[model samples]
Target chain A: MAEISFPLPDLGEGLIEATVLEWLVTEGEMVERNHPLVEVETTKSAVELPSPQAGKVVRTYGEPGETIKVGDPLIVFEVPDDTAGIVGTVPKEEAPKRRVRLSANLDED
Target chain B: MSEHTTLSDLEAAQDNTTAADVQQESVQNFPEPADAGATETMSMQQALNRALAEVMTENPRALILGEDVGQLGGVFRITDGLQKKFGEARVFDTPLAESGILGMSVGLAMAGYHPIPEVQFDGFAYPAVNQIICQVGRMNYRSRGTLPMPITLRVPSFGGIRAPEHHGESLEAMFAHVPGLKVVSPSGPNEAYHLLKYAAARQDPVIFMEPKSRYWQKGPVNAGADAAGYSPNGSRVVREGKHLTLVAWGAMVARCLQVAELAAEDGIEIEVLDLRWLKPIDAEGLAASVAKTRRAVVVHEAPRTSGLGAEVASTITERCFGTLKAPVERVTGFDVPYPSGDLEDEYIPNIDRILYGIQRVLEYRRG
Candidate 1:
């Protein structure tokens, strides 16, 4: 089985800690990339954290009302056994670099 | 040897004649105006208009683009009659799309024109956020110096006037967070006019925010040398005091002025600082003010969390730690979406809240 770890995404302004307001998905439930997993309240406003990878939720590190920093793992997930080899593999750095370039082109003249 | 010397002497004589002729033509032009005294008292809108008019007249390449700027002269009439005075080519209106307006301005700037585009309202500027952050903000760095986009975005923002949702927003932090952009907001008419003129001359992209609520407010404009002190990247001490430095920008500057007046009544002396420029902030001036006052309170109309005030407070604390007598406090908008315009007074920090903040800081200093 493959493991999926969800890191905090940028909620704007390089904000680090956010209070966990609620968990939409529970352990043992399946989730898809970009699916809302937890609701977090920042000093500015409440935001929903999306799953970065598709997998079955195996565990949660923190409960509601706890504040977590950036890069803190919120949920762990188990992927299909067949896809286990690719599950935890980190994408090449070139991928993000290329994507940023492409997005920049779309907006830049 | 004699033939070569003769040819060289002839070339030198021709160069001297050409240089003399060029100097004569330059001297024949009209003389510039003499530095004169300052003119006091102009509305914020008038200040902006004067800045635009001055810049456009001084620089032929400078132009303005915004909705209703051409015929209707903008909602607040800041651009009133500019189109007629400057001709449509220099000052004109755009389609109702903020993204289109900003994106087109990027293209215009790339073509070597200085385009100062206006977002009609604070809330309406959201559509262009993508263009602003992803494109306009990073274009210079992304291009690796091959392109320099010197566009100024003029957005009239903030609340207090009972307008609909999206009318009042202090989005400076959003722009400030971007790496390659500059952000500025003026507290009064003089600053608005002077800052706009500075923005027109700048070579980098600038987000110039105007306080919508204070559009009609009037103040000493200082038409001469005092105007020179207003720059797009500097802060000014609007009032003199010793106990604490109260920092604010845009419409809040006026509010801070009112607070200072009321505080004076209570026998508390407070210095008011107008942080005209948001990005590339005047750190030196701010540090100096905080050093003298020993206490600081940053105020803004934006929400308290992750707002521009947070950055100012942290910076002051980091640089002026030993000099500070109390923890830097912030009088800002409640950590909530801007409330209805009617309840804005409650949500937005006012004279009373600022007074309370001053009292708290003073009390902390006592202990």
Candidate 2:
């Protein structure tokens, strides 16, 4: 098992910090990716930040009415070692399909 | 040696020079395995992730710093899980300041740390050009070797993803022009894996242009094998042909291969050469391929005016002048500013345009 932290990401448009309006998931709660974890309000607007990856919530930082800076850990997750938490979509590994078979002829002058 | 001796030596060298001596030295042979041992079918993104993991593991001094790199695992997740695997200190994020990201890397490099900084997107690198070209490129020369800027600046590059105006521009021509910066673009997953590792290991700063469009495309990558024989600074012939050579790099390499396939149906054999390194272009490799085919076409997504294609065409003309059947042709984007996503299909060199380029070269006459 490994512990992964989810930082308060820059919501958009250079908003540096956000105030924690509420926590959607509590400690030891299991969450799936994109599941709402917190509702935070930045200068732009109040937005619900989703869980970046699926894991058992180890802890969530900041309380209602508290502020957290961007890039600061908002929550942590305990996940299996192999699943290594990922944010964006890592395209599934599929066998490369190529119509024009090419060779890497490095030795050919 | 004395100035007089230098002059005499110059004259002696001139006396011994032959037509063969004028040709660019052939690229050094690196016996890359026909099959990378213990290969894993992986996407370019996964390969890059694996490479960074290996780089961090092998070199404690090597760390990655850029916008959204740490907890977020990069905007593309190329640095995914790296912070967790390594640590926050080694794989951390900076604020959305491109200049600061690069500037700090220069300082870190000066202090004996190998920094692998990502500019997030190709368009974002514009804000950091001053730091990249002035400090990162010239630091070692200016310091007279006292400080070597061993930096790997990763920029997700090129169009085809329908990105915004600035996000998909091809900046290889601009980076290749710099005196001290070494530019390399990997065409696929295997190339990305080996090339990124190769760039990170070098003492000089390398601009590693990751082909964003090809990031999701999966291919074989040997995680255990080291990129021993190949020079990341040299080009490689990905396909062999006798009719014509289609010279390209990055996303265009794959496109050219597709063109070659279509051309094959029409009985036209096309060679696709991936010009891996943009700066010290494998002129010898270009000459060797074009000389055999007696025809050539350079394809790129960048605008045609003073682009890298012009340099490539000129090199082929100079080296293969005696044996060439026709002038080198180019299939490239227009001279206008790289457009937004909606207009990308028109801006990037497509298969039909490349086929026309090949046709032009094949049908050229001495008249």
Candidate 3:
């Protein structure tokens, strides 16, 4: 398993720091992607931070009412190693299965 | 890593009746993916990451700079885990400015640093065209060899993921037209690994176009420390046949290979030639393959008007005119602004279209 630390993303336009209002999910809990992981209050407004990926929540940084800076570690999740943390949608490989047939090999030995 | 089946010793064997014979001896001489060395199954993304890592470790002067490349490991994560491995200075990020990224690379190259600048996406490269064509392309000639731009500009190119308009574009023709720029795109993980390292070790500027669509597609890659002998100068005969040749690069190469396989079911043998280097194209390789089959069809994601396919078709005609049976057919995208995800199915050439093209060439005859 690989440990991926989720950074506190910029919640709003240029918001530097946010106060942790509540932890929606506690440590050692299962989390689903896009679900509310934590609720934090920025200078402008309070918002819930979604889990970036599905994994087991190993740890969470900052307790309720504590301040955490943006771009800082928000939480760490343990996921299967093959799950690469990427931003875009990379299409899964689907190799077409076909019957084996001997095509001509024109190479002269 | 042990050398994986280097057919380098095999002489340039050409047989008119059998296009497959020249696979052992061709202009674009590289090991077969299965035999490229002690191989490991990896995606093109991982292969490229390994290449960048090796290049950075091998050359102290080498550095990678682009938006999100440092911390996020690039939007596609091609630079994943690199900044952590090599530190921030060598593998760092720049602001979201294509021109600034390329302009800074030019300056870094002038200062004797081998800069590997990533454009983020193919469509985003438009903002840096002035710097790319004017400075990066002409700096060596402008300085009269005093300044050799050893910069490898990595552009994640071509459409298939149904991305927004600018996110996916085949800009090979535009870059290839530039005199000083050497354009090359890898077709698979193995080619991505070898070609990227080869491009990095060059003095001239190389436009290393990575097929964004093929990023997740896995294949065997020889991730060894042997970077001394590989060169991305010519075209590779990926799959050989005697009927007709399917010429392509980037994402289209894989499509053509699939088309070839389907065509084989109909007893039509199609040779697939991966035109790796867009500029300084292996005219010899194109001629040699087409001459054997005496028929050809060029394919690409770019518009047919002046796509790289035109140059390839013209090269085949000029070199193998007498031996050719039919005019080289072009199976390509329509001449319009590349469409968004919804219309990509209609815009990009599908397998049926390519097969139809091959059919047209196969049936054509001189009066």
What DockQ, between 0 and 1, does each candidate earn? Answer: 0.01, 0.12, 0.22
Clashing pairs in 3: none
In order of appearance, the predictions have TM-scores of 0.68, 0.78, 0.86
* Chain A TM-score by candidate, in order: 0.70, 0.76, 0.81
Between candidates 2 and 3, the one scoring higher on DockQ is 3
TM-score of chain B only, all predictions?
Answer: 0.87, 0.91, 0.90
Interface alpha-carbon RMSD, every candidate:
28.2, 8.7, 6.5
Quote the lDDT for A109 in model 3. Answer: 9
For model 2, what TM-score does chain A reach?
A: 0.76
TM-score of candidate 2 on Cα atoms, chains taken together: 0.78
Compare candidates 2 and 3 on lDDT and give the better one.
Answer: 3
Q: Candidate 2 chain A: minimum summed lDDT over ten consecutive residues — where?
A: A84-93
Residues B92-131, model 3: lDDT tens digits? 8998999999999998787667899998889999999999
lDDT of 1 by residue, B230-278 (tens): 3345688888887779999988887787777767665667899888778
Off by over 4 Å in 3: A1-6, A10-14, A27-30, A43-46, A52-59, A76-88, A92-109, B1-35, B225-231
Give the backbone clash total of model 1.
5
